[model samples]
Target: MRTPTRFKAGAVILSAVALTVTACGTGGGDTSGGATADAGSGTGEIKVWGHQGEEGEVAALQAAVAGFNSSQKGVKATLQLIPSADYTKTVSATSPDQLPDVLEYDGPLMASFAYDKKLAPVEGLVSAQTIGNQTDSVKTQNTYQLDKKLYGVSMYDSGLGVYGNKALLDAAGVTYPKGLGDAWTADQFQTALEKLAAKDPDQKVLDVKENYGGEWPTYGFLPIVNSAGALAIKDNKAEGNLNSAPVVKAVQQFAGWRKFVDPNSDDKAFTDGRVALSWVGHWQYNPYNKALGQKLVVLPLPDFGAGTKSGQGSWAWGIGGSSKNGKAAGLFLDYLLNDSNVTAMTTANAAPPGTKTVIATDPLYKPGGPLQLFADGLSKTCGANPPTTACVATPRPVTPAYPVFSQQFSQAFLNIYKGGDAQAELDKAAKAIDQDFTDNNNYTS
Candidate 1:
């Protein structure tokens, strides 16, 4: 899902190659201050940066920063909005003088920056104890990291799920699957799709051309692989487990369902009232609600088997390593991550709350709502933890070279859907991924 916020201020659009910076460098030396500058005596200015998009979101962040600045007598915080697409480029290029004291970073980019030493270890500022008191999924995605170092804190959690149009199910006289308890197996899911297809052979029930990049598939289809007990990448090695018996069976099942999906359809295939269900993220709540004008029933993505490790995804906040006012920035980070602030951000973003406390109490999470079901699924079935490296075994990676990786994965999947050999395409893609890690010195093994 697109972050509702983006960088405002002056934005400089760049060609695909060169890194770009937005705001002109404001002349000011680093104002050195103690890490524990008392709120009453802390006298310095701290600049905060984040993606600027939705007006309400930007205003909310600005208000939070303002509250922090006003709550203290000694320090002031300045807010700088950056466009989401250009944030990484701007953050990477800016010197200490121009970078913000604190930043809201995309989770996937955190590892790349941390690996490059562009971000500071936040362990000293926030403790596991503090995070533990928040949401389980939020803490799991944020605190768990590569090399056992805590580099980011998540403000919201997002995951993929099947959004069923209850009206469509009712019209077709099909019973909506129970929560995760009755989650369908791969065959069951395909059977349901085939039934839906047969019910209206003239129309599609799902869209097959949707992008499978990153967590969308992890949330939508990885559970199938996991249920099959298929190993994606074990011990940092490429495993063609995708071609293994269980996985192959799952893939074949998916291909069967493709018959009922219109290859040319877009998300509107469901959102525009053309299909029975759509694979989407929790963040799509607002747009979906706005379009449907009623609550959509969400079902736990069906499992391929009886596996316990369901894949999930998250977005996090990180601090820049080059910031001169590291302490002030850390303080601001702590404040923004407080339970209340995290809940506010997650709710505003229309995503699942990261903390357990909020998940238990957020009004949006009614007992039978889709959000609550997602939260339960997260608690019972999410994977061990996300990989700290740039690329993962399945879906894709979050490295600096993600553009190239995504392009390759997209092409390979398109080929597979068009009658190309799944093994051949995956093998070719795996070799490319291995080469990417080797060439970039990202391979750990």
Candidate 2:
């Protein structure tokens, strides 16, 4: 959750590797002692694994683990941090019995692990209140519950929006949106871009982060497809849905904005004042706020016919399916989701809190707060269904085939943004995704 750029490759590779690796069944063994004993037991140690994130992230996580370890007795918790680049490889290579009792994973990849039976259901194990308190978007991300069962949970969630320079917009006679409800229409947005470009020294009005090229295109631009009332997948397939008229039209409109975009190769277009608007995530808040101070303003992405939409979901926690200490692991999860801990993690990451209580109290996300638009957008997620006009926050497709879907869609975005044929590239992407889903038998056993 530090940023998509850090761990995208590992997650992409994890799913492909998972499909080839033999599915491992539930069992128990000790990671430290190598003993044939249940680590999930009340008295045994609970080993936790998480991605080594940014400096603040690492410090916050260590503090949380330390707090949990000292809070009580009986079950001791130890955390092991894996470098982001190697997190997936380590999980793929480890034997199930040797895997940590508590594992941290990206939200979208939960389906791949749940389908492989690598994670256990969290419903009865974690408290009813804990699960119930999570944001609707969090529930959608964590649950492999299309079968009606819970699996994973996260401390915080991710979102996307437009960051505008107030002075720049004002000087250009451009009106910025107050919130999601008043988000600019596609034409209005394009007009604003043109106006801002005229005022900008470099004539680059937007930074869509073309440099952070892994899972970002899918995370940041899928809203363009979703806002147009189109989806990348439906009924477990991508053929007709992805290559449909609305999707192509939406993508074409996005490509039309290419001339105003800053290549952002050096990643300083927005921060350095070369660009007036940056289409990015919450992780950029501190830097953007620091640079502009009173001039920085956050707004929802433009409405693309249907409504203003954004993407949601981030790193979450789960109990390993093979751990015998489900109760102990659940306790740790419950501890992590408590208001204080949730605030700690979300504050460190500058992400939206997973729980309602923290969001209500958080200065950055409370009503009329600078980042409230993100919370409002996340509260109206489309869940596992296709998005509609009313849906504003759409999670990535919840399917084991997501890795393939993301890869293909991202490549199509790059090609289309570079002036490739939108329809042709999307059709090629749709076919490749469908082939992967077919090869896996729609991921249905």
Candidate 3:
């Protein structure tokens, strides 16, 4: 389990050619240049790769790998740590030799890989009941592409939440908001922010100065949009309803709260601790909690409007398509998803457990903490894959250009939040999206 930190904007560009080479098998088959029955046996080596993290973060995975190696006399497993900065590029560019028998991949990247057929289905390897029964949303994310074929297994669970400074709230004489199930409506949430800000008129509460609160406007505001019944994108199409009645109403309400908080600067608002609540992820538990010392209180993002749910994001582990050791990879994946392994990882990483059995038994989860809120939100949230067209198509093809599309969407939302002409910005973004879809032959119209 690894709590993900933000990545730098520009790192390394992955060459498609390199990816192709790495993904396809090299001509030489074995040590003797011929296919052999012991290809994946102890005489052969299996490479496994994933992002690097804190020492204890991957202990569970290491333990599981150790167990597999000790129990199976046929195979030897080797681990490779890829820096998060180049992880996506490196994974996407895997040569047959570079590709791991089993690997961990972020969910959106996994979706893209599935679209490209760079991943192999794990349908027969693990029972849907075993994985699916753990967390329906995770199962949905894992099989979100290509006719619901299982491409990966969820290693752990995580969701967005508000990391509050309890002392700050107490100092402001404000009450902590309820869990997602009992989250505050848009107006109610704003009112809380306003009250917190008013307690110290000269102090800042919410940050929006830099890039107009780019990060928060995306994650924090997403659920509000959903609660307001606005869809960011529907059926691979960008929706202008972002400025529609419900969405605009939600934004306006949020903007009002922003005014009371740091209407001018993003840094001062959050760092000053005048902001009683900061929208963040479950992975931020350690760093943020440590920053606040004993002042931290984790809570779900406040629900806005009448909706009973919130939006969520999750990650999973996927097996590379180019690997020759499918059997061994499957066994490794099975061990990773077992309740004990999942629990150990999530607990160490400060993330929520993805499986039902793990979540139920994990000691890290308190009865009414943010983990419970995430479990509740998962039941209501929608995923980006399997696409809205899955109901009509068999083995749906998610556009290979989804990452580009997501960037455009993020930019458009940024423009709107920055006080740009909302309708105009949306129209521009819609046009670009339509063009992208059409150029890729992924659009319906």
Candidate 4:
């Protein structure tokens, strides 16, 4: 079942070199492949591809295309919505000639496509001022450069934070960790967790949702590592970074959290009083608040000696180099990025809006709104803030090897959760990743 809200960004896990072949060829628009005309020749059907979601999401996309077809006379835009699970697979499986003109991709993989020359130059399609107007999250996650050209742009950003059972904190004589301003310190957070464990010996203190595999480990657990004063990945590699002293110490402490947390994978653990906090995405806002009522409060992750690291970057769109109609495809993509369209899509999914203009105007995203804390947290971690001894919004690693890296890191994290050595497992994962890098010539990044 596709969770309409699951930002299951493209699961581009295929590691074989063969995958790149399908994504690239001797093309115009930056890549070496069938030379593309200077612009959309017009009159040809412009195929747009995106992952399927809720009815409203589907409607929003269809409505965008309908508007495009109606507004233009020569180029007719058509949206082909693929199942969420098959999105990346379908893209990878398509031959160069069969690829979509415009593709909606998960924010993180933008660089991967650009690295392989699968996407076309984006700066030429849109203005620098237009790209500059995007949110920090979009700037960090969506845009990429290859050789010398900029390749992609994000349509929106998403939010991640913790849901607290306020009663659990109060009854344990602990003050709730507020939003970014009063986020708990590393030591304070652990003390609070300990207090909760002492109060209800059988209950868990934290739920980072490790059981829902795929990108959860990298997306969910990586913040703790970053918050500990080190990155989980750096410059498209993880050797020294993932196994750095700070990361190792952080993982060691997280292992201690196991004794305080219940193994249950359900979010209801908080509602049932089986847990005190659930580190989760903003999508949990309504249901979690509904369950916990006035006792619920959302908070940023504790600053683990360094700074809090909240995730940004969600889904985004870009034009493929294989498109015969780059101009028409870019038009459709830009239409989808318009304020009204962005508002509709994000509001339907209860996600944070991506652009500054949209975020400023959206009621739910305004300061003091129900999800403002989530939006604020994302700003600090992945936004324009610089990382040093303070909290910051960090972008995911830029390697084309992410799918394979995500898999190994997930296993390593699971091993640590199950009482394995953090350093050993991380090193093992890094070794495996480096080996794949050597095997594929680092995906020619």
Candidate 5:
């Protein structure tokens, strides 16, 4: 399973350091020793590596691998689990030939890997039907599809939005958005927060999971920037887009909402009724629903002038560029993505399913379901350069410099959240990102 979306406050500082160290040697666009030749022709032993997760997640993965191994005789697949934190570093340090036949990586990182030639296109290897069955959002997340060739596929994806307390909302006379089309405007959201705060013991009506940091800031708060009509990067440059007026203003506006936010140190602000609204992801659904029962309801994120944008992307699978067992690996990968296997994984992690068929049958994400808003949000993704409005989901930027790109933007946002000057922080991050891009020769190799 993925780590909790929120991290302890101090993890913010540590995340930057860990990410820097993890992505140190992963620059350039070299294809040397990469699997440029057709890989569908190879077969035999297939090695697969996945992030080590919780007991249930780990069990689900193990079961899938077992099923795949038993279903065939021409090839044998072996599974290995690595700590999520160290998975990237381990892969980066390994020679291409030493890498696993198939490896799981964070969805947004696929561009970086593909640029570095650490991944091979999964288009011809995996079954066409398996690839076609994926949701539109999943396809967008795995956008490293150079020359129209897909490089990765995921069994499940992630979602982000608001979870409201029906009683608290009604008592405050606040009307929350039911779906993407009716998301609350910035004014409406702020007013709702104020009203909800007035009825709270501590005057904190919202929980943005402040006690957490790390990727949490980027994953949870970047949408505010997007919704405010700004792209973190545009045309392979960050200077103008990321530090633009819209982005700075969005950060300032978001910072202004701190007064109504619960720190949620014990992660009980929402579950304990200390907060009327929770801005989180699908991972918290079970607990939030269990605690509030009939009072719990899922709502769309606030529309920040441009539109309501939410975050979507998660761990996905890709073939190693140097894999000799690419054909065999594809077989296991296809099996792992089958409907039953996808259901098993989604059931264990409580994430949105990657495939369209599975999503249609999911209890939480299906139409008229409690979390249907999340599914609906995914259907309206703002791709590489989406229009200012009419989009609900925004995939993280696709770039080989993303490791540095994400690190810089996330740290800048965290600084803004902690009271740093928004313009200054963003300007600094944008410059650093552009410099990295220059150092990597624009990653056009």
Candidate 6:
């Protein structure tokens, strides 16, 4: 059995989730504290796990749960919001029978859970047509296939969009990259970086957020490689694809930003006027809007020879493989996905909606809204392919071996940014990833 390791926001895990159809008499709902807690009043325990630490998102979820609780005389669920540090290990360490009824997990890592039978096949529980109705990006992130069985459905979605500080750009006397296009060419991007750096010799010009380790590198840097025309993994091939000449050139180009990048910088750096350009997502929109006002702009990742790309996928919900109450849990999952609840979560999180219907009505994502750029969910397979000049995202590669792929790729990026050989590091990472594919039987397609 694979050991569940801690998720550093980059790591992923697998789970099995189910719901019980039977309804027990109503009882007072109780909060589950650390380790474990009482099941409360229900047919049986329907424990739901989430990892949102923010007060706003937590309150939003609690509100949704409260609604679920009031709507039923059965299946009172306790939302055990764990700290991210303790989350993955808690889920992985618990035996199948001990696992929670439902899991709120990072979408990218759902494959690992599916591979290990942590997630029950959701195909029969939810209709194929209903699942199909989800936005392409949201659907792709939560879907996990193993021997042709899909494991789960996402409750919501989130993605990153490149953002620029117009004031900083003007200070540097450079024009912001146009939205609705494939982003700037490599030379154009470099020229902009140079201009920004030159304008503030003592201040950092770019914040690639290298200080964030683990899965972040894959999410933050993989798009650059994708835009350079490389697939982290494709057609059971890893070596050539990840180590392609174009991919290496992209890494080289990113490394070239070393002089302008500040690894030690935090999110406030961009909003505080320390950096001219950076990568952030919708969650920061409120504070960013408050900080920079009209000067803040969402942008697409600059294209290399290909097109723009950026990261996608965020927290998603799934049923545990051994939940005693599969039907009830499924119902809760469905409740969480309801338009009103989904809107509540999106509104609280300040993120793009996970489904098209929600986005259609969401004022935040409506045309001319601050988050409209990210609301598009990126064009072309969640960054799996080169997209148009449109500021849509190119999400990270989805695979059962993502944890390993992310770890190795993260290390390699660290090396390249610190003056290590780009081709050599990527080549090494690719070899390791390909071997993992073979060991895992190419995810047993």
CA RMSD for every model?
A: 6.9, 4.6, 7.1, 3.6, 2.8, 8.3
**lDDT of candidate 6?**
0.66
Model 6 weakest lDDT span, ten residues long: 18-27
Badly placed stretches (over 4 Å) of model 3 are: 1-44, 95-98, 127-130, 166-176, 207-220, 240-245, 260-272, 287-296, 306-311, 366-370, 383-399, 443-445
Candidate 2 collision pairs: 40-325, 145-148
After superposing candidate 1, which stretches have Cα over 4 Å from the reference? 1-43, 92-99, 127-130, 143-145, 208-227, 241-245, 263-267, 290-295, 306-311, 381-408, 440-445
Residue pairs that clash (backbone atoms under 3 angstroms), model 3: 19-93, 22-94, 22-95, 22-96, 23-94, 23-95, 42-74, 134-356
Q: How well does model 3 score by local distance difference test?
A: 0.55
Report residue 361 deviation for candidate 4 (angstroms). Answer: 2.2
Clashes of each: 16, 2, 8, 12, 2, 33
Q: Which one wins on lDDT?
A: 5
What are the per-residue Cα lDDT tens digits for candidate 6 across 1-445? 0112222223343222210000010111111101111222326558889885456678888999999989887668898888765566566555656778888767776666665556665554555554655677766666653344445665456656667889889888887665646467778888998898887967577877655544566776777777776667886567988889988988898788788876643446677778878765555567777888889888877777766666777777777866656767767777777888888877776666776677777888877776666665433454344344443466566666676777778789889988999989988999988887776557653
What's the C-alpha lDDT at position 105 in model 4?
Answer: 73
Model 1, 101-214: lDDT tens per residue? 567665544444554445666666555555565555544444323454566676656555677877877777767676666666666777677667767756588753253333
| Stretches of model 5 off by over 4 angstroms after superposition | 1-14, 26-42, 145-148
Task: Compose the digit string of candidate 4's lDDT tens values, residues 1-445.
Answer: 1232363333333343423443342222232311232365646688888878667778877887887788778777878888766676676565555667888776666655655556666665655656766776667676552343445666566667778888888899988756677788777888888888888867567877654556666777777777877666655457887788778888878777887776655545766778889877776676786788888888887777677777766677777766777877766667777887888777776677777888877776788787788667656554323355454566666455565676777789889988999999989988877776676555552
Looking at model 2, residue 93 earns an lDDT score of: 64
Best by TM-score: 5
Rank order by TM-score, top first?
5, 2, 4, 6, 1, 3
The true-structure Cα RMSD of candidate 6 reads 8.3
Cα lDDT tens digits, model 2, 1-445, are 2334453212332444543342221222111111222334565688899998767778888888888888888778899999866675576567666777889877777776666556667876778999989988889887763464667787888878999988888989998899878999999999999988888777878988877756687888988888888777887778888888888988899899989999888888878888889998877887888889999999999888888999898888888867888788888888888998888887877888989889887888888778888889988998877777677898888776776787788889889989999999999999988987676666665
